[model samples]
Target: MRATSIGAVLSGALVLSASAVTAPAAYAAETGVVIQKVSVNGGKPIVLGTSQTESFTISVTASDDSGISSKLAFLQIKREVGDNYWSYHGTPTCTASSATTSTCKLTFKLDSGWGVPRNTLAGPWKVVVQLQSKDGDLYNNGGDITHPVLRRGKLSVDAGPEPVAKGKSLRVTGKLSRANWDKRTYAGYTNQPVKLQFRKAGTSTYTTVKTVNTNSTGNLSTTVTASADGYWRWSFAGTSTTSAVNAAGDYVDVR
Candidate 1:
């Protein structure tokens, strides 16, 4: 049969192999198989950069009255409302914990430039698990779990005029950027909230001094009164589509 849509493409082209099984319309009610848990990237977001390939792990735990089959499992990470998808291309390593429960894990590698063609594709994505039990019960679902797939963020900080007198204004500058998969480079992440932090010369802690928003070009320039010897840096809390990042501290001395 010819595939027509994104779901169909997954169901037919990549998921219909000899070892793969598509859930029948009534598979849910007739089966005792239960997908107990699903974890992607160890419960953290899958972050990607422009040129380097990022590899992540997916794990599916399922149980049934009968033990799961020995066949390797299949997993698909796909966008909630788009054609973007990343699928496992190798065999999953399945380990049986008991007579009825098994956990299957697979690793998938994604090349940002080749795998992701659109920046809008960043955000929450769902996973589909396909497996069968020894007693013929099937478990294939896409709605039970979701994870964020994001672009890696980059931040730079510069705080200057060394040995400034106390109570004098110090100029702090920075820029926030993130991976652009389509352009295969890094670009500014404009209009995002970033926190300016300071750590005293002898302390191991950093406290927020102020919150500044990146301008049109993701550039940050702010002024603060020098109080003591400390390190200044910019910290981005990040958003749904971008990962959080902190710039290396720029030390300033106050005389």
Candidate 2:
């Protein structure tokens, strides 16, 4: 068959013909799976600080005129960062029972700990989703018979807290905002957890301060009362399990 962009025919209804003659049919060889919608339920862009759990839903519709051949189609998700990769299977958190024809749905919950690396640069992160046929040949003729897939959208990243003054009380705050795929703030501590640490400005020995949680508004603020008066620096560690992004903000003061 001819090669066509999977995203082109993802919407509306589709018809396909089933013939025993092999060697690849046409663009109509298999039923198309359309990703109807993707939503990050509570908040988008979740903030960078403390641990937070966020939920999401992905709606999809599939149909074929050649009859439903594969009933066990599955959805796959991944976070893209250069050559690094993190993948997860979409769980069926919700489903429609009365639906007929080749219909498949999947649900996914990505924790903040599953996000960008602590040293990640400020920019956009990507989440990719794909569908796979369970019991069918993936390759047909010259083209692959893989299920249709799409790059959902991007996640925004920002700096957290860093450079703290020694021997004085320092306040650190941060905000989480969405990007690319509809902005949202995560609910509860389900987002990534924020890690705080300090060290002498010129030294490398780092000490743990405190790891705090962000409020519903994706705001996280904490006071660091130091015991000594020396050049000091602080760092905010990021995780993928919660909604906290890897970031760092620095401050200095003389006491």
Candidate 3:
């Protein structure tokens, strides 16, 4: 049988934006079918950078006494209640695990040019799924799943005074930034905590020296006493809307 896309089946679907709604777990309407599991991007947040498109797969595992239907499923990741979403326009491929259970999967692509809103927030978005059983039982959820989308972060660090007298003061400087989907550029990620780390020469591990917060322009700076030759770098733990980042180590010489 021909299958209808979830977006088509629920033309007036009213799932709210991630920022506005907290949806409950999806449950089948009848006892004939049960949705056992759902996974998006392998349960990892969808992260976007300046120019590359992200491709992810969604899988839905369901079971029914009457067996599952083949190639009759749809998946949608909605940014809002309306037409703004990443959808799998084709039929999902269903692989049966047992006579009564099957897992349906589909792939989707998200890029800057996909007609999605340029101002879409980098937090939780909703996942909507639809499926049918061979016995005619159907399952359609109203944004029952939540997934995160985040901006990719970048960090830079520079330790000044390449050669310094032992026990002298050394300076470290850096910047923290993240991808701005709307502008397609890297913009400063201000007022975030960043760790300044140091590794003694001949050592393979780095230890945190101090924590500094970025300024209004996402610039970071700090002072430390030079003890030994080593490398310096900055590390950001990341926030809900941004991905974690680390700057390359900058070498310093203490004479």
Candidate 4:
């Protein structure tokens, strides 16, 4: 994952104030720690991309009946957007195997690109966790496993008339965005329902060549006729606060 931990903590200043929705500060269970489950990404609702870097995977279940320890396993993430409040913290990799139970499989990421500089501010994000035990015990709360649908989004495409002539009529455009973070970018994702793939130059697979709906602003035109000459993309397949996306294969040249 070494993208430099995706900006292990890139920030000169973020201030904090996503309008509200902040919850973090209420720990004092005498420090014995016991979180049982916390699954994100796998729980679905993640499709962030302002440029790249989206390696998702978060699975944690901690315990410390005064008998589980061996370092630390943390993953604190928060978000707001509007005013600010976009935090990050990750250590990942905790395992007690079974005894007192301690399991973690963290690999979370949300890089805004520019070499993992993390510009921060995307959408819903909240996964507080901290399981440290080496006699200094400390396990923050996440009780019901954070929520807010765990959303994230960002998508856009534009496979145009690079060179169509075999049968003419090869017009495909796109833009079904999502991800505002108060206005970090991408916003047109209105009528949803986008999918129009095709791959055939050297074919590896990609069939669907229909289904289009995204107007009012999400834009996405349609028109296909030329045959053979592969590559073209646009797939959404995500709902529940946006997630799925596929746009990066624009190559057409049927002559």
Candidate 5:
């Protein structure tokens, strides 16, 4: 059987993307999974502030030539740092928001008891959907089941204080966090540099005002004198082990 071996990893293990689906790929002819997007707290880049609990919704699409051996289908989250381990944290039962041979979608949450641990390590991690063989399926010449292709995924960020008073000091705060496969919680990314940016209400461009660093708890906080009403946010440049992220814009009123 001609198949690409993923090695001695667990039968629960599998290999790796974005845009709600992988951009596209070259082939091995084995039916595999595509991770459209893995949202942290319902956002990307998995940014949190001094928080341990979270919600994760993994949008997955999958297929297989052997009618999609549905029983072994599951989503796994893997962290790069620490144990660098991977596991299934989605749910015990398989319930698709939608399903077809060419597509399958599932959404689960951490608090719902379907996500990673409450104290999982935070950083860039892999969100995988495993499309494995079923009871009636046949192996390729007795070879190990193959994982055809895999791509990478993006991180997430969340910014706030929807409106700030003008001329008054605006307190901007957020968390630097990412997926932790071991514990399944989106944990803080402590002691990292994050740039604060602003855009006036009349302008479309944002300029960097100052840089703030995360504390021991991965909390980001800073104050900027209010001037013109516009938007404010934080941007993490990202290291080799993590992906870059820009927080959502918070509108401020300088009145």
Candidate 6:
């Protein structure tokens, strides 16, 4: 079945605060499953070095013969660091009130310096979503559902000016950005490696020629000589766990 596309809004000045402590609520008697659509907005595969921010929204619609009343949900972000795992340490960054009609929607900002740990890689990251009653009953799978896991659909990086040319040596510099989701910037390079693929224009295929690690700033730069250049293109790719697949950035025309 085709999934619904959720829209998100992005802002650089938005700061998401954790909700205060509150007692959990009892589960709702609803019987139908909650259908949600998740998407990233602002920019895909965020660029490295450049400071960028993205927003995400989860629109939920639920119907049950039991009649749904409570309209509260919990959202959390989890990232993989090295061999271990880390989660947003404090309170939930996202919450939604019950809709007066039938649908409930919540939005949050993932800033560059949000909840990211000091040490995070540039590879695949995951965002684990959970829907629960303030009381504690699971929403999706009855009591069996502990969390709703939806991996980021796509992650990408954007490097401006693909076929950057100087004099003779082709000078290319681009920023790395993540798409389909937002990430916090750390003090060093991301745990994942950024791979660059390049091929002369006219070639039927390309090859992996260079690789670089996104620094704390998520910026990368490289220079290569173009031999008898017709046209050339370069690509940058990376991935994370919470995100469903890999992300990429591309550049072209280095003559």
Candidate achieving the largest lDDT? 1
lDDT of 2 by residue, 1-255 (tens): 111111111221111111111222343355333233333212133222212343344333332322333333444433445665445454333343333333344544348444422323222323333333333423112212112122221122222223434455655555433221213322323243445555555665656676665567545566767554333222323222222233332434334
lDDT at position 9, candidate 2:
12
Backbone clashes in model 5: 16
lDDT of each: 0.72, 0.34, 0.71, 0.59, 0.48, 0.37
**Candidate 2 Cα outliers beyond 4 Å, as residue runs:** 1-49, 66-72, 91-103, 110-255
Error of 4 at 191 (Å): 17
Ranking by TM-score: 1, 3, 5, 6, 4, 2
lDDT of 6 by residue, 87-203 (tens): 432223333334312344444444734433322433333333344433334453222211222222222333334454544565445444333223432222244455555555566
Flag the better candidate by lDDT, 1 or 3.
Answer: 1
Model 6, C-alpha of 174: deviation from truth (Å): 6.9
lDDT of 3 by residue, 9-78 (tens): 1111222223222213445545367877787767666666766466767787888888889745777775
Superposed Cα deviation of residue 161, candidate 6 (Å) = 15
Model 5 misplacement above 4 A: 1-43, 46-53, 80-86, 90-100, 114-120, 132-135, 138-192, 210-255
Task: Per model, state how many residue pairs clash.
Answer: 0, 43, 0, 2, 16, 37
Q: Write the per-residue lDDT of candidate 1 for residues 43-144, one digit (tens) a residue.
A: 667777775466888877777788888563677776634565443334578789999888898887665333654687777666678888898766777444
Ranking by lDDT: 1, 3, 4, 5, 6, 2
Give the lowest summed-lDDT range of ten residues in model 2.
Answer: 1-10
Q: What does candidate 2 score in Cα RMSD to the true structure?
A: 17.8
Candidate 4 per-residue lDDT, tens place, 1-255, comes to 000001111121222212222223344356756666676655544445444465666666666665456466677656565565655556787777766777776675456421212234433466676677556777666632343322344455666567777888888786766654444455687888878888898868888889999999888888989787878877776654455667766778888
Better of 4 and 6 by lDDT: 4
Q: What's the residue-level lDDT of 206 in candidate 3?
A: 88
The reply for model 4, stretches above 4 Å from the true place, is 1-39, 43-58, 61-65, 68-77, 81-97, 103-126, 130-136, 141-169, 179-198, 205-216, 220-231, 235-244, 247-255
RMSD of 3: 10.2
TM-score-better candidate, 5 vs 6: 5
